[model samples]
Target: MKVGITGASGYVGQFIVRHFLQRGYTVRVLLRNVQKTKIFCAPDGRFEWTCGDMSNDVVLSEFVDGVHAVVHGAYDHLPGRYRGGEGDNLTGFLESNLNRSLALMQLAHGAGVEKFVFISSRAVYASGHLRGNLQEHSAAQPDTFYGAYKAAVEAMVSAWAYQLHWHAVSLRLTGVYGVVNPLARSKWYDIARAVVRGEEYSQGRNATEVHGDDVARAVELLLHEADARGQAVNCSDRLVSNREIAEIIQSISGERGPLPPQAKAVSPAVMDCAYLQRKGFRFGGVGRLRQSLRELVEAVQKEQRSSQ
Candidate 1:
């Protein structure tokens, strides 16, 4: 089967490309710039690249043509926070993300793609203190522009699936950490860097973490499994406090810096992935989390030494 992916150069997209390639599936990556593809695809020549921007209908249609499935991972963040009286940020985010996603959906449908997988966020659920496990059918009250945009897209994808008879899977992902590019800044990276630098760090309340490889594996499982169709699954694992994560990095890196004092600890935001697991999707669990963090720390240190 041939699979097409947007945002093929991103942290998540790269893993998906590699996952499909290892499984002997033909993969086509939609990249705006061909040069960017060379950097990531240099290690392997298994995947093909199609030059196109998501906004271009012609390009999108061409990219999706003859593909069994398409995974939409591209998301554009607004210039400013989508809060307060200034609704401009929300407008920009919707135009770039929601609008682009809708266009891509239509293009994929027109191209007769069999399945469409959208990587949504866990933020779509109602925000407060997550008192219990958050399931797929949980109430959602997106408070921010980013969350609102994702929620809207999720609804759009579901509607499109019903009307077009297309298999749509929206995976609501939590904090995904793994072997991302060293240059990419994530919460995990930030905490790891602080530990390595022996700098003071502050822990935030309510942060959930998941390994990127586990996320990639989940996507792979969904791609082959017909049961994942027409369903929205939450993808996450056990929650870890920010300070605990920092300490883990320090331990793995062999850094001798004194662990920062624990800040206020808040209730963990639990995302239940029971539906996904029932469909035969598996994660690396706590072990995978440790391994991913170790690999990330080693990669960061290696890059740091090389830079010096």
Candidate 2:
């Protein structure tokens, strides 16, 4: 099987590449910068990297040729930073994220790619607070521009699957972490560092955590599982409070920070993974969280030592 992934150098994209390689699939990564691919690809040269942007018709066409499946994991939304530069604000974000994704989907279809897997976000649901468990069929009310863009693209994927006869799977991911680069700061790493320093960390009311490896595994399963087609699965593990997450970070990082005062408890936006569970998607839950945090801390320490 040949699988092509957009944003192959990203945290999620790199993990997907690793997963596909471990499963004996020939992987191709679509990256704008060839230099970035060097950091992720194995020196054995088992995988191929194509240089191109998703919005380019010629590039997108050539990138998906002869690939069995394509996983759309690239997006422009930097977790805490605004990436879309000065322009029609909405258009810039949409072009970089949603429109580019749609174009890639079309290219995949034209190239006879068997399956298209999209990594969406749980933020598509309403923002106030999740009153109950969020099921796949729940109403979507995205509050942020990033969430709105994901929701919009999801709708397009669904339409193409049903009307255009394309096989598609959209996985609404939540709190994917475990990619701890000393130079880069993800939400999880930032929170961990803050807790380690005994600093007060303010975060959004709705957040859930999932290991990046686990998320990649889930996507792999969805790609191979026949029943996953034409379905939107909500992917997440246990619902952990912000305070609980902070405590876990402290415990794993050996950070002796004082716990922050309990702020107002926010309603949980828990994802209903019943469908994934029924499909035999078993994760280590909070244990996965702990293991990921420990790995991140060790990685940070190692990098610090090397720098010194």
Candidate 3:
């Protein structure tokens, strides 16, 4: 099966591409610049990339020409943030993300793709909803433009599914974590480094997080799942706190710096994943996180030593 995936060079997209390749699928990636494909693909040496912006109908159509499925994870945002990623240009943000995304959906549907998997975000849920037990059926009241855009595309995915009469599942992902490569830093790289360097980290944030590999597994499962059609399923493994993160880092790096203060008792939106669980998808909990963090911490220490 040929799977055409967008955003193959991104931090999250790298894992999805690798997972599909490991599963023995013919993976063709969509890239804006054809030459940039060498940056990531050279390592695996097993990718067929379609070079051209997805906004260009000719290029995108060529990409979806023979693929059995399409996984869309591309996003244009300001560096280091997603919620307020628009920064100064709301119109540009909407035009680039929402408009182009809808176009991709229409083109994929027209090209007779069997399945469409949209990488949606948990940002679709507002902070109010986070206070409760969040489920796939939870109502979405997106607070940020980023969330609103993702929610909008998700609605379109379902609508397109009705038109296609086949599989389309929006994996509403939480804070995705893990290191795909040394070039790509884990989400907790800075925090772990600060704690390792014996810096006091008082401010700690907590959220539901899943390993990147697990997110790919969810995508892999839904593609083959006969029952995963026209539904938005929550794809999160467990709730992770900043204090827990400090402890994990300290345990590995042997940092004696004070572990981050206990996070206050706040209602964290723990995303319910009963659907994924029933589908026989197992998540890499803290154990997997620790292994990934070990590699990340070692890299951080190596960088710190080299700079000194």
Candidate 4:
């Protein structure tokens, strides 16, 4: 099988690429800068690359050509933030992120791709207090432009999958954690870095998160599983607070420092992944999380030492 993917250099995309390569598939990635290919490719698998982004039609047309599946993960957003990713270029953001993505979808369909996976976010659900588990069927009430765009794309994926007779799924992900490499930081990088330095930092909040590897697994499941076609599945592990992460950081670093205090955050809702659970998909829970964070801490230590 050949899988074509955008955002191959991204945190989660890196994991998806690695996982797909490990599964004995020829992976083709679309990238504006091809220099990052070294970060992803291994000796055991065949990896191909395209020098373009979502905005380029000719590139996109050729990118999706002759692939079994498409995984779209690229997003043009402000650095380190999604809600206000548009910054001052609202029109540009819409053009690149939303409009061009729709173009990619159509191209994939035209080329007879067997499956498509759109990486949607949990931000599609309305912000504020959630009364119950965030089900996949929950009505999308996006509060940010980022969430709104994701919700819109998901709706299009579902509708198109139905009409085109293809296996398509939108994996609604929460905060994706775990590392691509020791130098490649995932979620919670800063907190872990701060703990490695034994410095005082404040990020007293919690969020629903999942390992990047598991997110990749969800993508793998949705591609071939008949039950996943045209479905929106939630992919979340559990709610992890900053304080708990700090304890793990200290434990791994053996720095023995005071932890961050528990502060109020607009968090607490956990996405219900009943469909994934039913599929016997096991997430790497806290154990894997700890291992990843420990690597992050050690990476920070290495950087610190190199600088000194």
> Best candidate, lDDT-wise?
4
Query: Ten consecutive residues with minimal summed lDDT in candidate 1?
Result: 78-87
The per-residue C-alpha lDDT of model 2 at residue 102 equals 88
Model 3, range 185-244, lDDT digits (tens) per residue? 578887877976899888767778898899898999989897888888898878888888
Off by over 4 Å in 2: 41-45, 82-88, 194-206, 253-255
> Best candidate, TM-score-wise?
4
Candidate 2: residue 253 Cα off by (Å): 4.5
Which residue pairs does candidate 4 place in steric collision?
Answer: none
Per-residue error (Å), model 1, residue 211 = 1.2
Residue pairs clashing in model 3 are none
Cα shift from native, residue 177, model 4 (Å)? 0.9
Question: Could you tell me the TM-score of candidate 2?
Answer: 0.88
List lDDT for all candidates, in order. Answer: 0.76, 0.77, 0.84, 0.86
TM-score per candidate, in order? 0.89, 0.88, 0.92, 0.96
Q: Locate the minimum summed-lDDT window of 10 residues in model 3.
A: 37-46
For candidate 2, lDDT tens digit of each residue in 173-216?
88777663323554466666676556777763435767778888
Ranking by TM-score: 4, 3, 1, 2
lDDT of model 2, residue 157: 82
What value does the lDDT take at residue 57 in candidate 4?
Answer: 87
All models, RMSD in angstroms: 2.7, 2.8, 2.1, 1.6
